[model samples]
Target chain A: MDFSSKLLEQAVDEVSQLPGIGKRTALRLVLHLLKQPESQTVQLSEALLNLRKNIKLCENCFNISDTQLCEICANTSRNSEIVCVVEDIRDVMAIENTNQYRGLYHVLGGKISPMDGIGPSQLTIKPLIDKVQAGKVEELIFALSSTLEGDTTNFYIFKQIERLEVKTSTIARGISVGDELEYADEITLGRSITNRIPFENSLKN
Target chain B: MDFSSKLLEQAVDEVSQLPGIGKRTALRLVLHLLKQPESQTVQLSEALLNLRKNIKLCENCFNISDTQLCEICANTSRNSEIVCVVEDIRDVMAIENTNQYRGLYHVLGGKISPMDGIGPSQLTIKPLIDKVQAGKVEELIFALSSTLEGDTTNFYIFKQIERLEVKTSTIARGISVGDELEYADEITLGRSITNRIPFENSLKN
Candidate 1:
């Protein structure tokens, strides 16, 4: 698209470089910023710049934080012995919102996706293995998604710590609570049936 | 969603302020930026800030520009006597992309929408009228969208210049060039039938 101003064009070009935004959407967003108060743009730019410049990763969990350690890692009340291993901070937020898990998290940053050139070394797997080997963790729960890369990463990490004393487990795979049985995928349904628990155990949650 | 870091939270909040972006998409975008090189964020932030701080509006046509006068308004080859009235710069860009019209443009910034508390006085309607009154324009074409607000704005401007010698017209409304007749909306089809152009005239384009 032909833009009247170079500044406008540059801004739209930069915004469209984002993962999902296209050129037209970027133009619309930039135009919106133009129509708004100048302070809005200033605050947005400052917030993004400050975040990129000053943001930190938790020393223990590798989750994003503003200080040396993240809030969850810094908290003394949460159980640090049991770490839920997952891909990125979004998973951490999702599990935290459930309010059921009391254990801390170890953010893997990403899965072992060879197609994307991301191997086990690109993730935080070594630090996690070090934690387990140091005897700081009692139980390690693999909370990654059920994709092939997720399973590969999980298996890779499990193999490294299998000889150690730490107990290893994975999050359960099952049909959603309110979903119909007929709609569940075959593998999930079969696993849910095979791993069935007592009726009293279901009522406990 | 709960964000672990205040810096990350503020960045997400600011980004979500853009139109059509929600908190979840905002978080995803922020995380994506965090994963990319720091220079990427710096360039994006600087581009936005520079655009908002230094952008200019063309004095003649009110289109966005980096100079006092826009490129189209500055061009001597374009027909200044024939001015196409549009709602915003997007319309100008769309028309420019067509490469069919040689006339200049007069951007009204927005249409007359009372529901949104926008009136003719809030737009660039006065400057447009002044241009016509100064005997600089021979023909004025209304190219705003075929909406209630657009029609109101067109009629309002037509009334102001009706007594003058300048001729006034509106862009044609019809089924799109490649659209199927069966799928065309009733109102557009009816208007297309009512305002059908001469068979010979249609062949000229």
Candidate 2:
């Protein structure tokens, strides 16, 4: 109906743009922030501004990173030879939370979705193949979703790696469908990782 | 487990500090923001930063305003003498949404809460009494909560306005609880306004 100030209206508009937030909820939040100490709102603004400015994608895995390389890629104790391929950084976090995988990661950014015009070239496949071609990587684990695009991306990776003679596998898809690897429970995800199936052997006839 | 960058971590921490957000939800939101274009994020940051800097408290009614006097107080058609005293600006918005009330508002900022150490002196009661004593005001509406603090604040306001000989009333408690006026559905809040009871009459019995 009526707003007190342009700034209040602006703030509510911005907050409502966020995922899952509507106009009413945004207004409530803006009012809540108004009641808190000024420093709290200042910190939140600083944090949001800094998040985009300071964060960069890791050169190695394309995951979020403070340095040139992500923490997982830089750690010497991690298994560099067994690389886990994921669709995005969120997947890396989900898998890391399981505490079972000690391997390095390769973020594809996204799967091959022709509808979205995202093909293999749009992904980090060239670097992935290069990493595999370097001769140190013993096994490559496919942890992409079980969607059609994910399946197509998986098939492309499997075909490319077949020429190298390296062990290749895909995380089990019996418990998953569509593009929801980002929100799967830890137990189901952990189980999928543990029960990975050999793509080459499964397809051999 | 592992974060992409320190800025991302800091952003997540700041987002989680909001009223109902937690760490996981904060991460999800941060990732969502990250996926958005830089222009969108910049707009959000600008909105948040300008919230306090651009908005001012209306001098006349204590409602938020971009100018010295709020629109409601400046309106010639509105009944300035029939001030609707409310807890905050949200109540003002609620009333304005109905398109029924044409009276000005008096924002108390908050009610008297002894446990939180808030007292009558901390509220806008002094100015309200002054307005009533100025002899222009004919009726004062108490739109505070139904909670103990709201009742106490109402009693304190009633005493202050008693000597002014101006009629005083409170919105019906049947519609809302203390601090919950912000969430009352429009119909209920409007009904409470229409069914207001005289504070002086209630005290007489």
* DockQ of every predicted complex: 0.90, 0.58
Candidate 2 local lDDT, residue B190: 83
Residue A195 miss distance in model 1 (angstroms):
2.1
TM-score of each: 0.97, 0.79
Going through the candidates in the order shown, the clash numbers are 0, 2
lDDT of 1 by residue, A1-205 (tens): 8888999999999999999999999999998998889999999999999999998999999999988988899999999999999999999999999999988999999999999999988899999999999999999999999999999999999999999999999999999989999889999999999999899989987
> Which candidate leads the pack in lDDT?
1
Which candidate leads in DockQ? 1
Instruction: Judge candidate 2 at residue A159 and give its lDDT.
Output: 89
Q: Which ranges in model 1 have alpha carbons more than 4 Å from their true place?
A: none
Tens digit per residue, CA lDDT, model 1, B1-205: 7889999999999999999999999999999999899999999999999999998889999999999999999999999999999988899999999999999999998999999999989899999999999999999999999889999999999999999989998999999999999999999999999999889998987
Model 2, chain A: how large is the TM-score? 0.76
In order, the Cα lDDT scores of the candidates are 0.95, 0.85
Q: What is the TM-score of chain A in candidate 1?
A: 0.96
